[model samples]
Target: MFFSVVENKSMVNQSGKTGKQLKMTSYLAQEVRLARRHEEILSQRSVLLQQMETYLGDKKTKKTWQTQAADAAHKRNAALLNDIEAAEKKLQERVYLLPHPDTVKLETLYWASVEESLPKWEEFLLGRAETPIGFKKMKSAKWNISYPEEDSQK
Candidate 1:
């Protein structure tokens, strides 16, 4: 009896205009499925973009973002070198002649006289009798050594 009832139910479900309605409903289901697929792709793209943004926002990546950092460092180095060179030029420009008047005038009265200037001048030019004039002597034989004969023989 139950089997007969189930067969009757199936017969009615397959009958009349419901078959055409079912076909239309299946078409709508396919459309909905396609729309859902598009939504899933868009959602995945959004998630990927968010992940990329987060990666770009990291401190190290943000700070050292490009090869231009090396260029900027090189520019800074060049500017600093130019500044150092300019400062050295200014220092060289102000360098005065030897017997730098300010230093010698304050230390000695030798520059004051007019007539008896020869001996003080010689002493000043030739250095004191105690310390001979010329290049400093090597503390040890750690450097090349050479001595020229006295100019009187030449």
Candidate 2:
């Protein structure tokens, strides 16, 4: 999931940075670096995929890419693909710059009030009191995704 503070997008696209946007520039720089790395990995993975496709399409060239070699290459390609996907996912999470000082204070207070009030009304409003269970399930569901080895290391 991607999250960003307000005014972040305009700051990112602007060439000339004002005092408030300097932090955003640095955040954009980090995102750019990650994006480049993601693209490079994707290109490398694409080549491997194309090679596998070629091997699959042409049966006459069996000696060129043997069965065992193709299987090994397929494993390598799968690993590379996983890496590419991970990188792409990382690219989605960016460092968002906070808005101006006064705006921040105002928003903070507003959200604090919302949080303070939410719990009291949460049950009545959040429950599917009138709606069907199936409809609510279709609208929202909990998700859990695992990266076994990678998550263990972290």
Clashes of each: 0, 0
Which residue runs of candidate 2 sit more than 4 Å off their true CA positions? Answer: 1-20, 58-154
Give the CA lDDT, 0 to 100, for residue 73 in model 2.
95
Relative to the true structure, candidate 1 reaches a TM of: 0.33
Candidate 1 residues lying further than 4 Å off, grouped into runs, are: 1-17, 55-79, 90-154
Please give each candidate's TM-score: 0.33, 0.25
Worst 10 residues of 2 by lDDT: 132-141
True-structure lDDT of candidate 1: 0.69
For this target, which candidate reaches the highest TM-score against the unseen true structure?
1
Model 2, span 2-102: residue lDDT tens: 33555554545456654347765688999999999999999999999999899777874666569779899999999999999998777655323446688
The candidate maximizing lDDT is 2
Residue 96 of model 1, lDDT score: 44
The CA lDDT of each predicted structure is 0.69, 0.73
